[model samples]
Target: MNATRSMLICDDEEELAHELGEYFASLGWHVALAITAEEAIAQLRGGLAPQVLITDLRIGAVDGRQVVAEARALPPALCPALVIIITGHVMHNVTAADLDSDFLYVKPVDPTEVLDDIGSFLAGVAPPPA
Candidate 1:
């Protein structure tokens, strides 16, 4: 991960969220793990404007796609949060043209690669170690 860029690991699965958050935290990202869609929204409401938002496809009642839409519906400045969609063992073939996400990957994703992708777009946001 870039020692720059605030990131959020959003998934209803607590264990999975912690695992991903820990991995990115090791790389020096200011990462927060959210176990529900409401929590994710609360984080944003509390001024945690993450540059990158990583979420699971099937997150309990609120799926990743819906999360993106809700997050985008926030203030204009938060409209284009770079989203990384995570899916299960068998991910649905969703095209980029069909969604407004930066990328999508099936589990188990490589933490290193995820870091690289976030780093690629991090212009100046410093990643604070959690």
Candidate 2:
């Protein structure tokens, strides 16, 4: 059985967030989702830091980059949470290094592919309790 892990999805799309959260939950992940940057920050402040953080690039006013930057500023162990981005936004000159995500996938992406990437990333990473 796949070990259950926690994941956070920060997307403003209500239906998409629910769909992805349910899909990942079905795959044995404990999932939580936030619809905006402020809400996401609240979740984190409320001690909802998951093993992975999946966010949309253009969430709210601050955007995903700001989200990552804010969260990544935490203690080293808590900072740098493995982040993934799935956006329809056009990113002409960007790299993961320029953002807080370890994986960058465009919208219209397959859920299975996202899960597969998460699984592989988790296999190599030690999910912290931080």
Candidate 3:
């Protein structure tokens, strides 16, 4: 297992968050999950430097954008290698470009597709558009 492969998944839906975490962990990734933006931010600020950050766009009051900002604000070495934003309500927010995210996915997202994206990125190959 690759202990060094770590990721943070933040979502207001507790079950989905845990499910995603379990899937990633099963694949040998060190996964951290948070049900709120504050919790996610705290984890990041507390020094959990994950290589990947996957956050729901509407995560309670703070939203995923705030979490993304927090992650990007970290020091260069600590910043996530990839930022993926998932949202069921795509019309409620600005474009992915505005968030500075590597990928923007609409809800009902297939976990395997997310895994594929991460794999392609880490392999220095661009994943197909979302």
Roughly what TM-score does model 2 have, to 2 decimal places? 0.87
Give the C-alpha lDDT of model 1. 0.74
TM-score of each: 0.80, 0.87, 0.89
* Reference-based TM-score, model 3: 0.89
For candidate 3, the per-residue lDDT at 123 reads: 71
Candidate 1 TM-score over all chains jointly: 0.80
State the weakest 10-residue window (summed lDDT) of model 1. Answer: 121-130
Q: Give lDDT per model, in order.
A: 0.74, 0.78, 0.88
Model 2, span 1-130: residue lDDT tens:
1545787888998889999999988878788888998888777766676778888889878788877776776666555357888788778888776675799988876899888887787778765553
Error of 2 at 64 (Å): 1.0
**lDDT by residue (tens digit), candidate 3, 25-106:** 9998989999999999999999988889999989888999999999999997778889999988856567777778998888
Local error of candidate 2 at residue 46 (angstroms): 2.2
Q: Give a tens-digit lDDT track for model 1, residues 37-75.
A: 778877777777777888887877767777777767777
Per-residue lDDT of 127 in model 2: 57
Task: List candidate 1 segments past 4 Å from native.
Answer: 1-4, 79-81, 123-130
Give the worst 10-residue stretch by lDDT in candidate 2.
72-81
lDDT of 1 at 106: 79
